[model samples]
Target: MALWGGRFEKGVDAFTQEFGASLEDDKAMAQQDIRGSIAHATMLAKQGIISQEDCDAIVSGLKDISEQIADGTFEYDVNDEDIHMAVEKTLTNNIGKPGARLHTGRSRNDQVATDIRLYAKDLTRELLEGNVELRRTFIDVAEKNFGVVMPGYTHLQHAQPVLFSHHMLAYFWMFTRDYVRLTAAYEAADANPLGSAALAGTTYPLDRAYTTELLGFDHAIPNSMDAVSDRDYLLDLEYACAVSMMHLSRLCEEIVLWSSTEFGFITLSDSYSTGSSIMPQKKNPDFAELTRGKTGRVYGDLMALLTTMKSLPLAYNKDLQECKEGPADAAKTLLDCMAIASGMLSTMTVNADTMLDQAHKGFTAATDVADYLAKKGMPFREAHEVVGKLVLYCEKHNKGLEDLTADEFRSASPLFEDDIAQDLDPEGIARARTTYGGTGHDAVRAQLKEAKAALAADEAALPKAPESK
Candidate 1:
């Protein structure tokens, strides 16, 4: 029978029951639901709402159910609707009246809100840890390729020369921002909502603070209606996932481009690469491409939930039941993508020689030449024009600025001197950018030190995993 079948004359239609059931998706939160119930049961006993013996029976029954779930021995029935109903039904059958007393002062409204918050908290911490690991991988790659020069791009056109370590640290900073957003999501979910039964304060003398402390929540939610109705924390988590996925997708796209024949800047590890079934010469960056493609799916998950919550009325409703799967799938997708990207980066072979080769092409030293003329006496705008004409002359003559003789440079700008040749070397050009946060050796070394310290601080600040009451 359905848990709410007291006044009904007949059973629900099978199709309706199956359609309304959430066990298939929500069972992922079964452990969280059990933990929430344990805390509530303990609180109920402390408040004299239930006898200590009954609380003991309920706690023992829930612990047994938790083991069954972990061991894959828990039987799920579609007729039970959701994980909460399934676990409660099984508990009632096993422990008799005490199990029935478990729901005395709470409703599924607040109960499910509590469960989802707990689940979000746990997943957010996991993502934070993964972000830190991925950042560490970035640091490793940066330190490994410390002084390698590469072409920095503006609109896919070579704009300047930069160290590869500088490029890697750029991503390190992006992920550091992602870590902050994920931490915010965790804080948003750290409130307890167990005492707000069915969208209103319950008649029972419930001590919400006891449950809050038992569950390791920072505080009990102050408003009853808001407690059961709020899903902003879940939104926060999914939003963090979406943004982080976008960042990963950008990195993956670069990996794909770099591994291609035209770029020839990187070669992915064989374990992370795939071979064509028909083409004997084909080695593909399939994992990077897949991670890039999965970015859209994570974005869609965020949008689907945002649209579902856009026009809903306050308090719990059936629509909220549709919210769990989106964030759950998004979190898992992002976590897997982070792991894959980290592995690909840690194992991939960087072609520093090839990068340096290409870094010298495309007149990547033009900016330095322009700056040379400006420093000598030319106004910056006039220096830019001179370099533009020089670039055109070099293209027409099929030569690079480095290929130009001092006399040839003097033909374009009288400011040119014999020292201008040194300015055209890609390594010198890259190393000359010594401003803080620049691609120069000192700047990147400073940034790397800061990144390592920031990562260590985050690891130290991450909260320990919450234990069951």
Candidate 2:
């Protein structure tokens, strides 16, 4: 019989049962549900709602079911409707009337809310650790290539010369912000909702604070209705995952571009690449492409949840069931993407020589030339026009900016000296940028130090994992 079937004469339709079931999705929260049940049952016993023997039996029965679930020996009945019902039915069968008494002062509304919060807290920690590990990998790669030069792009065209380390550190900061967002989501899920009791305060003398402490929540949620109905915490998590996946997608797009023959900036390791069955020379970045593709799925997850919550008059509704799968899917997808991307980045080879060779081909130093003239008292606009004319001359003559002689440079600008040759070299141009956040060697070193400190701070802020045996 259904938990709410006592007042009803007719059973739910078979089609409705199949259509409304969330067992497959909510099954992932089985262990968390058991944890919440144990805490709730103990609280009930303390309040004298159930006997001590009943509390002990409920706890013992839940443990036995948890072990069976862990070992894949527990049988899940679809007729029970969802994980909550399945577990409760199993508990009742195992321990008789005491298992039934476990639901004395609560409702599935608050119960599932508590279970998901606990699950989110645990998963957020895992993602935080994964993010920290990914940042460390990026820093490791940057440290090894600090002085290496590359062309920085604006609008897909090379605009300036920058240290390779500086470029990599840009991604490091993007991911660090992702970690912050995840931590915020964790904070959102930290409150306990176990004693909310179906959108109202229960008449029983239940100690919500004690149950909160038992379950490791920061505190009990103050409003029962909001506690049962508010899934904004899950939204925060999905939004965090969506943004994190977008960042990863951007990085993956760059990885795909870099590995192409036209770019040749980096080559992914064979282990991370795939080969075409027909094309003999194909070394496809399938993993990076998949990461890029999966980004849309994460965005979809976020949108699905947003749409699900838009029209619901809440306090607790079946529509909230639709909210559960999205954040879970988003979190899982992002975690997998992060792990794969870190592997791709750590194992990929940087083709420094190829990057350096191409760095100057697109007039990457034209801005530096303009900056040089501007420093020599020419107005920046005037200097920019002067450099543009020089570039036009070089292009018309089928020559490069570097192919021009000192006299040619003087013809373009009277301030040009033989030192212009030194400035024209891509490496020298990159190193000449000594501003605090510039792509110069010194600037990149300072950035590295700041990045390492930021990384350490994030690592320090992560919640310690629950101790395992």
TM-scores for every candidate against the unseen true structure: 0.99, 0.98
Off by over 4 Å in 2: 466-469
User: How well does candidate 2 score on lDDT at residue 203?
Assistant: 93
Candidate 1 Cα errors over 4 Å, as ranges: none
Best by lDDT: 1
TM-score of 2: 0.98
Error of model 1, residue 306, in angstroms:
0.6
Q: Please give the clash total of every predicted structure, in order.
A: 0, 0
Q: What's the lDDT for all of these models? A: 0.93, 0.90
lDDT (10s digit) by residue, model 2, range 1-469? 5887999898889888889889999988999999999999989988898999999999999999999999999999878788999999999998899988988889999999998999889888889999999999999999987778888898988888888898889999999999989999999999999889999879999999989888888889999999999888889999999999999999999999999999999999999999989999999999999999999999999899889889888589999988778888899999999999999989999999988988888888898889889999999999999999999999999988999999999999899998887778999999888899888888888989999999999999899754211
* Residues 318-429, model 1: lDDT tens digits: 9999989998999999999999999999999999999999999999998888888888888999999999999999999999988999899999977888989899889999
Root-mean-square deviation of candidate 1: 0.7
Error of 2 at 247 (Å): 0.7
Predictions: Cα RMSD each: 0.7, 1.4
